[model samples]
Structure formats: structure tokens, C-alpha cells
Target: MEKQVNAKPGTKQKKRIKMNMLIDNFQLATLTLPTIILLGIFAYWPMFGIILAFKDFKVPKGIIGSPWVDPIYKNFQFFFESQDAWRVTRNTLGLNLLFIVISTVAGVIFALIMFEVKKAKYVKIYQTASIIPSFLSWVVVGYMVYSLLAPQGGLLNKIIIGLGGEGIQWYTQPQYWPLILLISNVWHGVGIGSIIYYAALMGVDTELFEAAQMDGANKLRRVFHVSLPQLVPIITIMTLLAIGGIFRADFGLFYNVTRNQGALYSTTDVIDTYVYRALMNQGNIGMSSAVGLFQSLVCFVVLLTSNFIVTKVEPENALF
Candidate 1:
């Protein structure tokens, strides 16, 4: 009799727990529904088209019915064995590495300076001014760059002429593009890039800085010891993410900004622009798809390798 009564109570508790779990699941699903739909629509669904890389990919045969490459890697072989491969690879890695270093350093500096500013109005003004370039489209930026670099009447050439120097043909010269691209990329990206560091900076415990001040740490000392250390994790994560894109390039920056000028291809032509040019010339969907797939695979490998290194060095900061 006593056991029978306890069984009823235990059964009721189980039912209540089950009901609560169902309700919690419903709430979670409701919150996640939109995100799941978007990922399906934009991310996962597009992956179905990856088969195009191996296939000839004609419109009549469609993605599924298209015939695979003879060697199953013909497209990749063509790309790697081509004369432009070394040049494009070199340009892509060189520019991106340079960009990553310069932009990260500049963004951190800008964020640190901004975080130290006490006046809200001044902070707002500085932020607004810095971010203006990021808002401008690449097309507009191309025109602006042209105005500054044009051989006939560019501001830079004009300045050179006034200074008793020869007017440099910037677009036609590959030697100058590394510096030009670096400056242009940094100028365009620093504003937006700094925002992430700034947000991370805001999250740092104010008490830590106060303690550092009490310990007789000057502003520069505090920056190096306190702010910079706190920023290391976020910076590491961002840099790791950037490493994933080392094989890629900003199409707008390399293409539109350079006016797709063949002369600048020596320094400016990257994997993206090279693939684009190849696709346009050959009109081969499979080749273009192969390039995209190659980029993705390389990016994935880079991300995994970088994350693995981070995990070994700083498990807490590693992005798994």
C-alpha cells in the first residue's frame, strides 16, 4: 500500500519534468527558427552546387547530370600548372599578409586611442570621420583613387611635379602598388576593423586599469601591460580568421580599384581576379567552380591549422 502511494507521486514528478522539457524545447526552437531557415537558404543549400567543380557543368545537362572532369582534378591542375599561378599566388599571399599586419596594428592603435578619449563628442566625431571611407562603395573609391593617381592630372603626380620630382604613372607601375594597396586597404578597412577591438576594449575590467595606475604604471606602460594583454585573445581570433582568407583577395580592391589594368597585374592580380578573368575568357563554369572549391578547401585547412596552433598555445583563446 505504501509503495503504491510513492509510485503515484514519482509518476507525477516525471510527468512534470517531461512537460517542462517540452516547453523549454518549444521556446528554444522558436528562437532559433529564423536563423536555421537563413542558414539553409544561404549557406547549406548553396553547398549542393559544389559538385559543379568536378563536372563540365553545362546548362543543358545541369549540375547533377554534368560529366565529371577526366582526371577528376583537371581544373585544379590547369590552375596550378599555369604560368600565372606563381604570380597570382605570390600577389595574393603577399598583399593579404601585409594587409593583415598593417590593418591589425592600425586598428588596434586607433581603437586604443579612441578608448582613451574622455570627451564623448570628440569620440563620436573621430569615429564618424574614420568610418566614412568604409561606407563608400568600391566604385566610388576607384574614382577617388584614379583622381589621386592619374598620370595626366592626379593630385599625387601634380604634387610630385610641384616638388621637382618626375610625375609617376602609378597605375602602370607594379613596383608602387604594394605600398598603394596597403595604404588604400588600411585606410578603407581600419575604421570598421577598429570597432571590434574597441568593443573588446570596452569589456576589459576598469578595475584592472585602476590597479595598474595605482602600481605607478604610466599610460604607455598601462597600454603595453594592461590593454594589450587583454586584447591578445580577440586579436588572435581575428588574425586566425584572416588567415583563412590568405588564398583569397578583396575583388573590389584588387580589380575595381586597380581598374583591372594589366600592368598592375604583377602586384595586384590575386586568385579572385585571376579566376574571374579566366572564367570570363573561357566561359567554363567548371573551372570557375573548381577555383571556388579550391579557395574554400584551402581556407578551411588554414582555419583548422591556425585554430589547432592556438589551441596548443592558448587553449582558452582558441576558437574551436
Candidate 2:
């Protein structure tokens, strides 16, 4: 410029601060860039396939070129009209609700027990052992369950025989599946679930516990007042997230664990397993997609409604 304009000292300082802030933000963005790209490629890209739910998908025709169903809702009608619809829906909702309640309670109790250990090394050992099961593939877990429930040579049957009781045909009986599934689900999941609650417990204020001790509170009393109360927010958050997946079932658990036996289908058949069977047996992609989309919609609505209620009752704990 022809004329030199003098800049204020405060203006230079503000500019420098803005520049520094921008640099910090840039560094953070660079660190997160890989994650963003991966999510875009895997998660967002597959979203385009949602169109298949409406289309009468044909192998010869690509997704975009496929003809839309005649009634548009025809694919959805196929599922709703099916005889197994009510059974699968009920099993999905019931089993998931049961799993949520039991797992949450078990996790909390385990965490509390771990918290009382006092020694860091022992706590680490316990945590590592518990978490190991969560990493095992469902296929491996299925085989383990099979070994325990096999008709003749199964571990449980051997024990029953030892006790002079008849060996039960575990797989063929639907009546016993509900309890068996529940126990297996809790065992496999409780470890990882407890870790979450335990981490939250670690963040509790020590001063509160100290105050409780000073006020003549016993261990149980301190747990109820000091620890459980501290966990309410995190519990609320986790429960809300769980609610979002209420319409979905763990496909592996219901499928692999039950060995996909027709007899067990009465008690264990869920939307996910039903869709998988339909796809494998009938090769009806459109109907399967419709059920999946319906599940997603139901889950979304439930999550929003639950969040709304929580917001009204306890604004701070609401996820949104």
C-alpha cells in the first residue's frame, strides 16, 4: 500500500491468538482425518443400499436399475403378513429387554465387587479375565455351548447322569432355551458391561466417600448413598443407548448359540435371525431390507421418545 497504516497492539495480540487457535484445531482435525475417511467409506457408503428396501432387486439389474415394487409398500407387507412376524417381534423385544435389565444389574454388581478389592493388581487380573470372553468370536462361543449341551456326551448331561437323573435333550426342547440363552448371554456380556460401569465408578469423588466414612456410614450405606447415586447419570446414558437397539437382536447369539434349530425357533427366533433365514431360504432381498428398515425406524422412535421423557424428568441426564 502507498500509505502505511499502524496496527493496534491489542489487534496484533488478538490476531496471534486466533492464528494459534486455528493451528490447534488443524492439528486435531489431522489426527481425526483417518477415522472420518474410514467411517465415510464403510458406514455412510452402505447407506445408499437403503433404496433396495423399496426396489424389487434383481441380480441382472443393478440396485439403481431395479424396478420399484408395484405397490411400493409390497415388500413391507410381505413381512407384516407373515405368520412368524408376531413371534419374531415378541421374541426380539422380550429377549432384548431381559438382556438389558439382567446385564446392567450384573455389571453393576460385579463392578462394585471389583471396587472393593483394594489391590490394583488383583483388580487388573479380574478385569482382564472378564474382558477376554467379550473378544471371543460367537462361533467359538457356540462350540463351547455345544460341548456343554450335547445330547449324549455333553458336560451337563454327564453331570445329570452322575446324579442318577436322565440326560436332557437340550437342543430339541424349546422350553429350556429361554433360560439357557439368558445365562449364556449374561456370561458372555457381563464382563465388558461391568468394565464400563467400573470405569464410571473410578471417576466418583473420593471426598464424598471420605465424608460418608466420617459421618459414621457403613459400607453398604455408603454404596447406596455415595456410589449408586453417582452412577445414575452414566446408567441413564447407557440405558438410553441400549433402548435405541431394542428392536435389534444379537444375530450371532440367537443363531449360533441355538444352532439354528427349528425347535428352538419358537423361543429364540428374532427379527435378525428371521431376516437372515428369509434371505438364505427364499432369497427375498426386498422383504429382508424392509424388515431391517422397519427395525431401524422403530429403534429410532424409541430412542427419541425415551430421550424426551428423560429430558423432561432429568434434563442433565438426557442424551441429546
Give all TM-scores, in the order shown: 0.91, 0.93
Clash number by candidate, in order: 0, 0
Compared to the true structure, candidate 1 yields what TM-score?
0.91
Runs in model 1 deviating more than 4 A are 1-22, 25-31
Residue-wise C-alpha lDDT for candidate 2, range 1-320, written one tens digit per residue: 57557755598899999888989799887899999999999989988888899999999998989999999999999999999999999999999999888988999999999988999999999988988888988889999999999997999999999999999999999989888888988889888998888988899999999999999999999999999998999899999999999999999999999999999899999999999989999999999999989999999999999999999999999998
